[model samples]
Target chain A: MKRLVVMALVGLGLALGIAAADTPTTIRRDGVVLTIPQEKRAEVIGDRLRCLVCQNETVENSQAGLAKQFRGIIRRRVVKGETNQQIIDFMVHRYGIFVLLKPPLIPLTWLLWFSPAIALALGLLVLLLARRRRQQGPPPLSPDEHDRLKELLS
Target chain B: MATMLTRRLMFGLPLVAVAAGGVASYALLERMGRGTYNPQAFNNPLVGHKVPDFSLPGHDGHAGFDQAAIMAQKRPLLVNFFASWCVPCVEEAPYLDAIAKSGLDIWGIAYQDKAAALDLYLAKNGDPYRRLASDAEGRVAINWGVYGVPESFLIAPGGEVRWHTAGPLFPEIIEDQLKPALQRLT
Candidate 1:
């Protein structure tokens, strides 16, 4: 009886697995229906843009109406064979530098670009100060204080 | 005495830094609460650039104006991106009427709204736009780099985007901001 049950379960699993394997993996996600699936070519550029409405999510990941429209724009552009840089530049031309998820290196962004290095230098400075303090040992006691300390110890 | 001074300096410096940070945070939060400081607001790059070419279909009974229409205007035109679904746009409706009364041509773009709902919204609030267009897909809004609804762009007679505001237009904004700006440009 146990062997019969085990065989039935294995048969069911195999049937389900075969069905799953036969089904197509391609499909749209989150938004309006399009000819191409949501996770396709357009996402090459879409992945870089932030959805302004939802703030945290990328345009590809966001379900907001504006994000959907943005996706449509990107999909059409991608279909027209535009380069990723060209598409990104088009967005930048309209939305300004803030639209980029990864900010570009410009004169205004020098501080941002070098923040990690600045932080590392600050960390090193602190470590150096701490090491010097450790090396310096405790401050030398005054003669009167040393005498008082000896008396207390005795 | 020297050791005591150095010890005091070590502790006092961090305490001073913390206190300064707290005070700065308080001031910034106060400004935010008073609506004077907004971190989300960024400068529109389109300002001082010519208006991008776009032609949207006319919605309702109003005529849709394009880049050519704006170039032909002899006066400064306010291109307002609004939608019925946006709450701020409702607040801005009356102020738009006031601006129209003051003799500035106002062009309206309905961003991602249904015609039925938009008609109802305008009927209840007011419609002072000289021409109205529908941006059903929000393509044109993206082209204009509009971040949100109730955004206004003041286009100079020569077709440059002179000024832009990303929020509702209040009476004070029109009286103090737009009028002075128009006066300066014209």
Candidate 2:
């Protein structure tokens, strides 16, 4: 009887979960369904974008009102049928490149983005050079071992 | 031999487990942090979108209300989501009252608080909200993406949310940001 109750509960839980998952999400405007899942894509893009007010925070993570406002703006544009590039352009114009958490691939920001890889390579090169130098140096020989070897050779 | 093997296992086992656990935790945190804001979460700005359906009791309880109708008013509606306990809401009360007096169609939703307390609050602070709705259970707040109290949304004539403000709507943001959206809609 206990097993049957647990099974029934599990089944009920699954049904509720499925029902909640099946909730319709459609963006409709002026009686016409936008049909395109632009909001989903906009969220993905916004999350990648940074919040300028809190420089370290991405639009997704920061609860700063500005981030929320920007997310709303992005959503509005997407619903208005703007492309991703156009939305990005709008943000860049308004907030400047500082709004993007992931710095864009530009001449000025190339160093900011690629400095970590360069530093890593330099560190590895230094380690390799030090290791080679140590390897090329004469091996340490204990006094007793050296004396024994010298005596045997004589 | 068994003792030596046991000693090695004792040291190696914990090290492996710790390393595995550390790596797993790091990966999980990275994955979690990766879900930063994306545009998709907010694709529909209230232009022509069906207003988010929410029914809540009024401050009087005698007159219940729906958000869609208030939002679909001929004049643009300013919906402020506030809680009696929210400090920011208290701070912004004067500004809101002023804005409403200026003939802006301002409405308030008392988010997740008692209607009685809200009425008392308005009596004390000055009623800025022309019509107040009671969201005692926070259902309406969730549908509107309200994380905190004192958030505001400006709804256009078509019952779409035109502008959203997460915190206290300062004079500048209202003047610069919100005014533009309202003008465009009108």
Candidate 3:
């Protein structure tokens, strides 16, 4: 009975440890506590937004004071039940599309999205045309040249 | 005939592609150059929007900002975001002082700076702000969508942001861009 009780206690401790591991740590911002899910949503949104001050770093990765405050703003909005699009739109409205790390597919960005594909297609077409020309073997060397080659061999 | 056409296309197509690529890249580069330094050419999202209201602690022995009272003055307000740590802010101080003396209602919001340092800087350089507000955590400046210091906004009587300029204000910029905007506001 003593051994059984010890095994049961050990199992319970292991189960508790697993449960603790599953729960994400919460972050406090401006006196508001963000739950794990809320924090995750904020992080996802933050990762998509650029830190305007740092220029190259995303809001999620930047340690700039502005980025921290931006994260806090995201968390606050998340806690308030704003959708991801709503948060993004709010940021874009204030900071312009430059704030988005991955800008949406729009008319302005059409060249950016399609230029590489167009270039690749053009390159492949050129290669195929060149290969076909090479396979044709120099236009059969012309009929007169063929006859001249045959007489020389004879 | 087909081979001749194919050969011609093989040479012509690449030239056309190169020309197109050159033009496209030039256009893109020009656009990027314009977007970086020319804030006026690119539309500022904050322009025409109502300025966000903020009240922060006062520095340099002035009372804190009161947005309602500022709007109550019924004149165009020039809100300058500066910091004691920012070198451009120091360089632009005399221009701000000159603008203030010219009878424009100018106010300052100290961005992410301590009061003591701000006071020392103001004492040495000359305090140009009529009423100075301290943004210790920089929340107020963030609300204004200010990414850099030495940014100024000209607010219309009803609190609409008429014009905003980034970087230190030069005398020419004041005369060329700022003065014209202020004139339109009045």
Q: lDDT: which candidate is best?
A: 1
Please report how far candidate 2 places residue A64 from its true position, in Å. Answer: 17
What TM-score against the true fold does each predicted structure earn? 0.79, 0.44, 0.70
The lDDT per prediction is: 0.85, 0.72, 0.84
Q: Using DockQ, give the best candidate's number.
A: 1
Per-residue alpha-carbon lDDT of candidate 3 for residues B14-85, written as tens digits (9 for 90 to 100): 999999999988887885554334433324577898877777878757877766665666888899999999
Best first by DockQ, ranked: 1, 3, 2
- Model 3 DockQ reads 0.38
Quick one: ranking by TM-score, best first? 1, 3, 2
As for TM-score, the candidate ahead, 1 or 2, is 1
Shift in Å, residue B180, candidate 2: 2.1
Best by TM-score: 1
Candidate 2 per-residue C-alpha lDDT over A94-151 given as tens digits, one digit per residue, 9 for 90 to 100: 3456566667899988898899999999999999987997889876889999999999
List, residue by residue over B31-147, the lDDT tens digit for candidate 1.
666544556777789999889899998887999878888888888999999999999888778888988888898999999889999999989999998999999878889999997
> What is the DockQ for all candidates, taken in turn?
0.67, 0.02, 0.38
Which 10-residue span in candidate 2 chain A carries the lowest summed lDDT? Answer: A27-36
Q: DockQ: which is higher, 2 or 3?
A: 3
TM-score, predicted candidate 1 vs. hidden true structure: 0.79
